[model samples]
Target: MATAYRQTHDHPKEYFVETDTDTEDSDFDDFVCSDSGKSLDATIFADLEQLFQSQGSEKNDQPGKLLCEVQTEENIAEIFAEIRKEYKPTEAEWRVSNIDERKDHEAASLLDDAFESVSSEVEKSGSIEGCSSCAESVNVLDVSQFKKGQHISMPGKFGTIYQHHAIVCDVKSTSGTKAELELIHFENKDKSIRIRKGIKTYDLKNKQIYLKHYKKQRYDCQLIVSRAETILEDFKMSKFKKYNFLLLNCEHFATWCVNGEEECFQVQGALQMMVDTLTSALGIGSRVVKVVQQLVIMSTDEIAKTISSAIVPEIVLGATAGVYLLYCLAKTAYLKMAYKKNNLCLTCLKITLKEMWLGFLVFSSTSVVQLLIYTFAVPAIGSGVGIPLVVLSVLLSVALKMSVNTFLRVLRNPFGKEKTKLSRPSQLSIADIVAFSYYRLEHVAIVTDILDVNERAQTARVRCIHYGLPKLLAKRQIVEEEFEMNLVNSSWHKFDVDDTTSYACEKRLSRARERVGEKRWSKTNRSDNFCHWAVVPIARWDNYAFEEVNDKEKKNKSVEPFFNKYPGYIAEELRLGDVVDYKETGVLVRKQSKVDQGKNVVEIDLIITSFWKGERKTYTIDLKRDDIHVMYYKPALCISMQDRVERALYWEGRRNRLLWTTNGFIESCILKEEYLDN
Candidate 1:
């Protein structure tokens, strides 16, 4: 009967191989007869001949030949259709497993009725399972007893192998088993992670098959299994890799009596095979199909933030290991050069060991992290284990311990010891130079890595830095604002004269006050709008040192304008009568004056020819020695100066030396009152 069935139905050559044993064939025949010769079909017979013909070819093609034209979707559908038509369900006995015995017995009666109905359908003419077979006994396994295994496939991105799995403990849902098995095959075909090795099956009590998977990491495994449902749905809809988005997969139990090999038996193909079959079924252009494949392969499920948070540290550490290689190279060079004399110097040895140790930590941590992620975190957490909780628990233990140990010494002494120590610069030995260069390169790479992670802002900053002068010059307001009032004031010097003091006394007293202020401000008074001055925040400069201002040492002095007492002004010409005429004018006005707390201060107003008259007239003025050579500056200077003065605003606010400057100017020109506004 087996031989005849093989001849009659185009079962694959491999399926027929078992039939070669005549004794077994007879047994199978008896089973079939008792089941009403349901397996016999004229169409299957024709396909069997084709399988036989193909089998005569190369040994290697045996599987393919067995699969030959008989492997087609149409043929399998027809075969299943025939089987459904012939095998009336009522004729056979069926039972449910993993359920209470009493309930099972009750359910068995329902199952018997269902089988009887299907048996009647088989006795009739048409194919498709009868309504009775589809009804009451839809599922044979009682799912309550089973623990589901994980989904086997992962949405992948960045060339990493993503995989997942779960355990099946309840009476296994046959359909769910097919899904799991299909995923195992899918992983087997994934070339990215060297998963070419075929599945290894474990022989259980029944003829059930299981696959042992090698996962790159726990997280990858978890991610895959969690999204199994989405993946299978995607397969069904022919939208496996529709977009460059996260792939979602999930798992659930359902009935499965249909044979996996049957084409109409839709659910049991791996992602890769799905792609292949889809391409074949659609008969679309290869290019279009290829595009689809790329999308599916790249589709990845978004890991939960909690999972990602747990996962990122491993990635970071891995990246850090890459960075530490640069450090190692630097250290190697140092050992070869400067430390060559005492190759075994304890300090050098310690440094070498320290660096190597750090490198190992980085690498080992990364690898282990990836492993844990794929093996446990992803799968276990994804299976409702609460990933965040698990991650936190793990981090508080290992990460915390490592961090403390690594940072202990550095935290202990951030600065030098009490004793002063002179440091010798390591001459630019070849090793030193190499180490420095390596360090710089690695540092740049690290910076770039960070920037890549924060693409938008960093990219803009890089562009700005690239343009250099344009950004600086175009930002006039910014440049102007950057001016340090203190720096300008420190660079400029001026003398103040009092009514009771002579020139020599004023100069002497001014110098004395400047010296006194120097101790407080720790800076010199310079000119306003000095182009040479750079308004750099000491902290930002990397080269500046911080100093605290001494308030008690602040000088008590007042600035007396040199032009106050004998303020002189030049003449300007006016064309009031159609003729240019000379007029002696006092353009400078005493806008206001005030003295507060023994500090003398004065405000003078001036109308520059350019300000009051655009290049029409000019003024040349001199000041008396006692009046002082005080200069009236713009408000910007005063504002900036006040800001610095409030807190000795140095780069680090070291001293009470806050001064600033402004370029806007007003001339001390003289004009006749006749030309002035009434």
Candidate 2:
């Protein structure tokens, strides 16, 4: 059974891979399955523990350090430090372990089903009996001892793999004998954090719990609790959907609350263990010889198919790892150069490690999907687990990758962090830069032009050099009331420049508008016009014009896109007046027919403008090498055209940054300083 997804349906592969997401949707739907309710077999870890003990005995190894009982503060700290190191299998043993941890986890649902089937049969025979409850264990955790704003963590059932973390948000009736304690943590079903009172609402039967402690307080627990509370308050108003089991789960919530950063070392270690095992199993390293020999024996078509699919999780993992390596190295090198450091400072190491782990967290999401697909004995078609797992992976990976640029600004701390004081005038004038903080970074924008919509109301034509998907620059019209009052919820700063220069910039912007507006969509009916922004279209064949050629033949002849990095973006397909994503973007020609020119010859003879990248340059452009594409449809939003959007997309996911120009960074940004060396 095949399911067709709309091309615009949310999917992450569209960013890096060229294949139509619609086609991949069914494949993804078939390949990976996720069941949040499914539990890992406790015996898996029990087996690991048993294996470790047996191996220790076989090696005649001396007894290792046991976990020190947490009687004092030092003992608790020692337990955390030691447990992380103890019973840890070497990479070699882990890879060769009979358990095949990756396979087990990737097909956790299938394995759980199998375990259930066996258990059911055994129960029917009455040979195995079980009874369990934590009611008697109520005295174990002293509610009064655990204070508000303290961390509580629970280990996976067998006490080795995953950990769920939460913070004590409240203590009701502290003087009462049975003091009611409230904890906050992300709940998967709701996709938001919820506060629940004590063990009555939380299951604590089959796991060991830990209370985070330090000899010296390492964090402002009160502030941490405050952040978590704020999140809960905000979430009550909206379902944030920021909770994914693998990436932004409870652990990430807890950590972010405490440290102002999302992190999960347990997830990190587990993924590494899985990757190491899979890499060995896939014959990525030592088994390359075997793979090569197998490939050599295959027919040419088969080999071509295997290489082109790029579906092998291990291979994709390697490629992604390479990309992340360059990403991190470039970041570290640039920061070093910025600080002019010949020696590594503590900050350098800290930033590098931060980037490394976060980048890997996203990278790990990609591999998890691939491995999940590979796990279910992916028939030339259907495979493990199901839609839920792949969807979770897609959401996690895309969310994290999107966060990279946003996070860099926050982590770097110097790029656009301006200390110079600037005030927002009571009334915003043209060419003023407006700054606002959203999510993470400080976003800046220049008011291009102000338009008088009617006698009583006016709108500001605001534009920002946004580093968004498909395009870096974005513009829209906002009512002056909102722009001035509370839309941005931040103040605007006037640009300090000669009135003539500011006036010239204002004209250039008007000229830009006039250039594009001449071809802009006109409302069929005479009604109030609405803000125009890009809307990625669905039903490509219906809206886009393409030569009627065999897709297979076209695939071979296809060249790199000039406007957007999205695949198969042919120049022949673009209609006139369409917004184009380009290096200097964009002055789209207004016409009804397609052009005779190919995308490759795209020569820039003379473009006299002061835009970021297209600064009055006369150069020939080869679209094949550089990225350019007719961005998503941007029919001017009007009373009539608005109907098309509403009729087509029930809800466009989002029509969606921070920086100031005075920080000396904009110059470096425009120069492409990092690319200059290359």
Candidate 3:
């Protein structure tokens, strides 16, 4: 047991590791987004980088490729537009897939003729239209360029191979007008997430920096700074979390602060671009490469199969695994080609199935190797004793696992027709797994936030384990999804997941929110339906970590703040009539956030009619949240209002001025467009 202790933990420095050899791209000059308030989506840059890399075959020509070779940003935009035009489901596709109102999931497919046409044209182009010469004077990014709470990326650890991120927090002291600045960042060495001083600040200032800004704001700057401060406080209180490269690294910290989502892309661009370069250089698969198998897995699989066959030729275990894997690979490829249209749910299922099959293949062969090596060679227990002991132990382990699973099933679900009674929820815990059913399947997700503490207000935020298979895969597929709780209904049956990581709930929730927003907004044009829901992702998480926070603590630091409802202009652009949707089809939720004193107090009232499987219910669903950061994107024009009230109270007997009741019977006053304009 001691010898088998493989310290699988990543070296903290691996977070900064990059390719050894420098490419022309090693000097990929960082560009500052003019919009400082815009949400910095690193993934978009990755895609853009991919487009540029596609142009150049050699590494020498790949650096600054997009800016020089691809010509203007217009070419990149044109390509993206082509992708959208070709991929977004048509009316016939959407309706044929589900008239019951399932979210439109785009089918992943082979390079369509539209994409092929666009790619061919791009490759054939002989000109660089808006290409700037290499001798052009570049804008030098310095300390003075960054605004308060602005996200800044420093090029290092190999030029643009990866970037170190930080938030330009504030001035350390007044010191007249020329004050020293403080940057909040995650330091792997100190194992602290906080504001750095003199030497650390000096080191940061010396690095080549660039601003990550977008034209439209994803979140308020004040909100961004406040979350950064909160995370810092948690560190001070002895909740020490080490720097995990794959998990909570520096890139993850800075992005989470700027926007309420935790994403480094798990990426910044250069690292992924390097891998893509290798694939291209090696002449790996082509357009069809984007099919079922992961490229990395596919590249080395034949080698892995060869090794397995050589290792255990007589047992035939390796041969069995190889054949099964080939079958799964073939099946997935066939499914990908077969379901390239209306039945997108089946498409998602195919991907899920591929993962399962691949996992089984790996697990079966690995288990055989591990069992034999550990028993015979390791610890050197005699073959006579080890073989019988290992076999009996395996049988017992299998039986025990089966028994425990059956026991948990009994506790969660009684032996009767499906219905669960309220036993006072044991305790409110963060990142608890929420379990429910998706038709016949048992679906699960990590509970990211506790919406309403009240028993009757049974709604919670969840980050699913790909539980949203039936729904179209959005950027954030079914992540941070809020649904009504009723253990009986087919549309709703849910409870805490049995295995809740006592820690790491904050990371899960943040990632889910970010991904969900990413997926939904990936399209160039956000539709009217996007505005219908107001359930905002709150920035609050368990600090005491659900350890019975008292009433006094609850008041100052609200576990969940009920709605601070007031009738006023929600946004200047949104008219009163437009928000008060009468149809049970969906209910608009709203949120108000402000920093009172130093604490973030968010008021959220989500009377969202949870989009069910066309299930009609008498009661509309309700959910609540705290310290909300998500703000609705103000629409350019207000949606037209129709007086849908079955019965309306005429305001002074004028049809232009009247009152109506929505799905929740919430009375709202509406006036004509003429009056509204005035």
**What is the lDDT, from 0 to 100, of the residue 653 in candidate 2?**
21
359-447 in candidate 3: lDDT tens per residue? 44434544454455433443365445544655464445344433543443333321112223333332435544444565465554445
TM-score of every candidate = 0.15, 0.24, 0.22
Give the higher-lDDT candidate: 1 or 3. 3
Candidate with better TM-score, 2 vs 3: 2
For residues 173-245, write the lDDT of model 1, one tens digit per residue.
3331122122321232333221111323221111122222211111133323333332333333322223211
**Clash totals, every prediction:** 67, 14, 6
Q: How do the candidates rank by TM-score, highest first? A: 2, 3, 1
Candidate that scores best on lDDT: 2
Give one digit per residue, the lDDT tens place, for model 2 in 2-86: 0111111112221222222334212221222122233333333344444446676654221122111111233334333332344
User: Candidate 2: where is the Cα deviation over 4 Å?
Assistant: 1-145, 156-161, 171-180, 188-207, 214-219, 236-242, 274-678
Q: For candidate 1, what is the TM-score?
A: 0.15
RMSD of 1: 37.2
